[model samples]
Target: MSFAPFSDAPGTLDAAATAARLPWSALAEEIAALLWDSTVSVPARSVLPLAQGGSLFVMPATDRSVAMTKLITFTPGNAGTGRPSIQGDVVVFDIATGERRLVLDGPTVTARRTAAVSLLAARHLAPVPQGPLLIVGAGVQGRAHAEAFVVGLGVQEVWIASRSAASAEALAAHVHALGAQARVVADADAALPHCPLVATCTPAQAVVLSATPRSDAFIAAVGAFTPTMVELAPALCQHVALHGTIVVDTGDAGHEAGDLLQAGLDVATMPMLRNVVCGPWTHGTRAGKGPVLFKSCGWAGWDLAAARLAMRRAAAEPPMPAAAVRVPA
Candidate 1:
């Protein structure tokens, strides 16, 4: 069956166009609003293992006016195969009419929304919002975080570290292109004390960051999404849990957050992003704390937030000439 794009049909945005629609500032705000919105409902995602050693994720979410589902695949073996390991689409629909409204690049949505979530966490939890940033792991997520922090937090400098020197340098160049001073660091641990804002975006097969950060550091760990995948040392997790605040993006992190789970941290007792954003807690309450750790596991609600922002931005613009428009992939 072939489905052609009708004149009134919602536009299918590619990665770049989708990114353009969901600006960091607006997207972060939308997510923050949605976090406390009772009208929005997000069911737990279903993960199915493919025969070829990959996983398919089916995540669905809905609000009073719109609904969305993110269908994506993650194939770790796809690395170096010239194809992205995570590729798919986020399909949005009008709740009243039940008509499809937009199709967004899923990987792009994941990267941006995840980074936006981190930005939102930083906005409320970071001891120092503007800063020299240290990102561990120079992959898509690392690059996305660098851009988000620079634009959203007005970060002026970024330090990148990866297992691959070439990858680290490439990310450094990307940061420099964003008009931020980029430094490639040989050791992420060595840079931790200097950077108040830190993001770990690694594969999560093992611990890559175990350093003791400054008392005011805000660390966002986005690498591990499973109980077995780990990026931070168990000791580090314990330290933060003991001294500082460890806020999770969602309650699902209870089982999916490897860094906390492995460290024997009871995620169920921790304050969620919703609590911090919607509750009465203030940054001043964290004075003299060791560090604030924001542990993020993937959630469909984040994708829905991105879709809402993208749809609003798309609606405000005048139609482009047919010839000037780039067809969606």
Candidate 2:
């Protein structure tokens, strides 16, 4: 598929412009196709330490159609300097010609693609999604997941919980603005027993939800990427034999998801997101029954896929007045 004029369009996009061009549903659907692809390819992300006490990450993903790379940086000191702790840009390229195509805002790509990963998993793992939902964080991922799920699924009620009461209320308002029934909850426990669906998006260094997950619950834990950072209790996966195995974006996730690594589960032993999307998950008990949850550390493939979708959709629009247009890949 050729991503015409739009893919090769000139000028770098800011966060707002990037969001305007990439629709939530399109992002979820495009990522869905990429997830089930048996041949999906993405090399392990390259991590390097920065001399200033932070880090730099080089992540790239591509296929036969197009390619993209996100050059991101992590600067811990920037947090106190009134600057973003993470910053980067996404560079898209034409697969066949090896020519650079477009440069998109990295944070926007990261936020949308990351949220879409968990939502895509929920789409398949929680096939019977309905009723109230719980979101564990109130930051960017929190907002993105709320929007993606509320827009991509049939979520009726969304409950936001965060360490900061103000943060939770802010996200609740955003969800309500999306035309969904939403409110700020006291904490995760407030909705655990009854809320059938949940997505944890916090930055906590330790476990967040301590209650035993319901047999029918579908939790998407999107926070805690490093080994030292954990967001879910180990019993969740340990009980998969009787309840469910954690659903992950890729086998690679097990290496990054503290929840899985700390649980003593091998990435090779778990059912990946691909398995859930393409066929009956092999990890579930006898008949693929019981509780199901998705854990996402992160993935570059999602960025490549969502960027392509944005380009394809943006190209279909009537020619813009000022943006330069280039030919297809």
Q: For each candidate, what is the lDDT?
A: 0.89, 0.76
Candidate 2 worst ten-residue window by lDDT: 319-328
- The TM-score that candidate 2 achieves is 0.87
Top-TM-score candidate index: 1
TM-score, one value per model? 0.94, 0.87
Q: After superposition, how far is residue 289 of candidate 2 from its true place, in Å?
A: 2.7
Give one digit per residue, the lDDT tens place, for model 1 in 76-187. 7776566887999999988998778788889999999999999999999998888789999988899889999999999999999899898899999988898999999898
RMSD each, Å? 2.4, 4.7
Question: In angstroms, how far off is 5's CA in candidate 1?
Answer: 8.7
User: What is candidate 2's lDDT per residue for 200-284, written digit by digit as tens?
Assistant: 9876466788787777778888786777678888776566535665677877775687887887877666777777666665433
Off by over 4 Å in 1: 1-8, 320-329
Against the true structure, whose lDDT is highest?
Answer: 1
Name the lDDT value of residue 84 in candidate 1: 83
